[model samples]
Target: MNSQAIADRCEQADVELIRLLYVGNDGVVRGHAVEQDHVPDALESGVPLPELVQSFNALGHRVKDAQFDAVGEVRLLPDCSSFRVLDHEDRVAAVLCSLRDSESGHPWSADPRSALSRQLADLADEGLEAALALESEFHLVTDGEEPSPHGDQGVYSTASMRNGHDVILDVVDALQAQGINVHKYYPEYAAGKHEIVTKYGRGIGAVDDYVFLRETVAAVAESHGLGTTFLPYPFDGATNGCHVHLSLWDGDNRFAPSDGDRALSPMGRHFVGGILAHVPALLALTSPTVNSYARLRPQAGAAAYGCWGVENREAAVRIPTAAPGERDTATRVEYRPADNTANPYLSVLGLLAAGLDGIRNEIDPGPPLEADPANCDEATLTDRDIDRLPTTLGEALDALADDDVLRSALGEELTESYLTVKRSEWDAFTDSAATWERERLRDTF
Candidate 1:
């Protein structure tokens, strides 16, 4: 959206609050609500937000080694291109912001959004561009703090979609109104769970759209007296994830697949190879939550192994089948390892960095698995060549700490800050006996 268009919309809608939004390291959307009268100036000069917003943990507390104190502040410069008039509000609009240093007037290194922008810029410098489509899986339930399922319909059943039709429709409509391209909506494997796939878009725009989509989904669901959870495993035996499909382009030439032998182009293979090599470390950003690990177990459909395949859902990276009559449609990779707990900006940045490293080094992605190795018996995977990803958040973090390339790509500030926060979470989880432990251990003893 243009500035004039945003101004016009605000005037027409009588928008009273202009929200300056940012996604924190914790993968939550945090924002400041500004009165409409001050929005013009705020848009020009940017909203003043504490730097600690980026330094804080999931619970909104500062990490132990946070660089900024309470007094440090950053400017949230609104990206007018992403402005939206929210559906749940009577007179409110929102725009995603990029954090900028107040003193130096530079992009803050700690900002995840900027980190993504930097990677995209680097890709641009290499005469390449990336497109991404995010398919977010979420579960809708009746209202409460810990809501119950809205219905017990079989996974992907029409009944599941019917049960949450009103809420889902509202979310889809609102997102469409905000210029989000909603592609498909359908029931997912988990009860009361649904998946929505948006149209593919370029680089940062795709990530920005996802952030808007998630916030819109949550807000619209709440307005309908329904609750939704993107938690990787909010319920036992149920899994939710944000499966990302990616492709690279140099002008109009697609790099994902070549006309020659093998499904992917040499560059695309290297990209896949890079992702496989760094996936263990990538999980620290792509599947950051403790609950995320619970969903990454073997044979659970979510890929536990660092491998790619042709339409094999069990592979960490799956090359989706191309639609008939569309020559370039098959030239994309579905990275199945990510979940909603990941900060989208960081996740994209990490993947892009890894892929770029692969291209630069011309890394070869070994053979694509022809079968679902996660579902296969132990011997099958061993013979076919598959490696498991980190099965725990602590283990993933340890892998991230050891990956010097990934750490350098993310920059030291973000790496250290993220580690501190995640380590704290791991410590908290290990210190206490969770409900699962009590349920399994109490009777066993």
Candidate 2:
């Protein structure tokens, strides 16, 4: 679809406002909406947004060292293919945009979406394709002075499903109305917690679908007079996670084992090896918040150790068992160390960069762990070469700062900007009051 087609559909749908949306470095969606009359021009010429927005942190503070300020502007070049009329909001539609230099019309160096596109282009050069899916978990709460969970029934309970059935079904309807497919939905481990799994998408479209899913969930939940949060540690107990599932293809599923006895193909092992080797640094982009560390602890079901396993939730990377007779199509790697706090574009980019590096160099991932690393003795852990993931946002950032491969993949501008913004967040978190942190982060995603 092109600008004219989008404008025509907007007119037919009576869309009064068309939002040109983009995800900021802070993993938040920021955008401006235009009136219906301006849809065509806005889509063609692009909307101007302050470049300094790329330097802002989650708490809305600008990182001074990010090398961007109020003096310049970037264009939000709307991707017409992503246009969708809102099913929940009346007279409104939205399309995701890519940031471009206003003068030269080139992709901005610091754009997260553009960064992912660069990685995809490199992968295409190798004749490889990737598919990704997200298992999103979030909490629905009552909106008030002190928000609380909407339901008390625990994980996977029929009672919990009964309580949230209406709103959850409504969310599903809204999403499907916008052409996003739902693979499954269920009540999660904690009260008011729920999980929604969507069908996988190819290449950059996968992350774009994720962005839409997040926004749609939030919007539909709000319409029910309820508040929703994607924070890693919205409260104690079970934390919300947005686990990533990835699979590679080169005419066939590359991760699939050739023989029935093997766990993964040689190429698959190398990919997992790259992920384990770079996970400490990758966490800077995956679980990228001060509060995110609170969820990455041992025995939390959020991966704590850098290792891969078959059906092991405790490992950073897990190779799920394929359904009988579906090995070729279902084989994939599940990366469990991420949450909703990450910018999906950058998170997937880092994963691809690490995996591709492993493939090129044929890096061995060592042996897979069949049991939880937390239950293993220190000596056993040492023998297996498993290391605990970074315990804090600062520690992860430090690792990212030293990772030459990841830094090169992200490019100097984006890498520097991301580090500056994240470091400022870490400093603020360390210096602030606990109450302030909780209040500010409760609904950030």
Candidate 3:
């Protein structure tokens, strides 16, 4: 941004500059940018948010203008002024910033970036570090008004290379320009939906990257003249989902080792086991939407059965069979049950707690799923072992209510507020009639 242009923006918006950072994750400031903690100049200007939102979106949806509202919930930190923006060697591109009230500013806890930063800071104090990334799955919805040319439905098909290239390319371009390490984004089995795989990062940085990436992808898609919906299931579609890929470490070494010939390390196995056992509780955070349950059906790839496998993408966690050193950074568990609706910070935090619990208890994860793991019978599940992720958000909530371990991890206040918000969401969803069921059962019932 040029000096004149920025001045004009401030003049127009009525806010003064406090701090701006060119964030890599959202290709903008950050999607989780809350209304709290804006710069003094920005607050002073009292920029008409509607106008400022355009400039913010131009950075990308992920990188949005901080919503500074008197009526909103939290605030920001006391600070110096710096307008965070992306720039070349000498020029600016994306910008992330903050504001203040002259009084003590409120910090936005709802901002996933802020929350993750807190978690990372806590871990750092303990001399531990985290390495994380995301495998975001979003459905492609062309106009429900008129059908667009659909793409190949090949599951990981080489044929999909033929369609949706433009949308994928533009999204990738925007993300890369913002410094997001977009490893690859390709078409999924569903027509409009796709996945973006990226290099992982240490500490809170990885989830921060996720927050930005998702916001950027949505923002850029809208710029390209289409709607981008991360709602786990756009319209009760065939396969609606999003999954997060993650790993843990103190620094250079990936944690734990495998006890036998199976591909999972002991740390990895225990981690997967802990997550699987904690499914009912974890899903409440991981897949926090009512539509989310609609996606986690028996046949779809939403991963209803809580299990892991060596190289089985169908299972919740897939250990890719690629050569050890070939994609070493990608050596992590692919958690498939999560959807886009869940706050990435809380979702990832749940995983961290489960994995850490496994580590602390020396939990031994026995045997790998040799076949399509989800198809396994009750044979492996003695009443003690038949644990599974919640079939619905309501069920997950029930589990969450009972689990003090998980509740304490998220803090009493946050957990209560979050669950309360989700409960109302669930109730509203159940009350609303859907075209599918309305046509299918309204008349019959």
Candidate 3 on 284-397: residue-level lDDT in tens? 878877777877765466676666677766666666664655443446777888877666767888888877777667666556555554566677645335455577667888
Where does model 1 exceed 4 Å of error? Answer: 1-5, 375-385, 434-445
Per-candidate count of clashing residue pairs (backbone under 3 Å)? 0, 0, 45
Lowest-scoring 10 consecutive residues by lDDT in candidate 3?
Answer: 50-59
Please provide TM-scores, in order, for all candidate models, with all chains considered together: 0.94, 0.96, 0.75
How accurate locally, in lDDT, is each candidate? 0.84, 0.91, 0.58
lDDT of 1 by residue, 1-445 (tens): 6666777789898898988989888888888888877778888788788877766776666776666557788899898888888866678899999999998888888888888888899889888888898889888878767677777558778887788888889888888988889998898887888888899998898999999888888888878878888999988889899998888887663654556446787888899899988999999999998899999987788888989988888889988766654536547878999999889998888888888888889887788888777566778767765778988889999999999889988899878878877787776678675766888899889
| Rank list by TM-score | 2, 1, 3
**Model 2: residue 400 alpha-carbon error in angstroms:** 0.6
Ranking by lDDT: 2, 1, 3
For residues 91-120, write the lDDT of model 2, one tens digit per residue.
999999999999999999999998999899
Regions of candidate 3 where Cα sits further than 4 Å from its true position: 1-73, 76-114, 144-152, 156-159, 235-237, 256-262, 326-330, 433-445
Compute the lDDT of residue 55 as modeled in candidate 3. 22
Residue 104 miss distance in model 3 (angstroms): 6.0
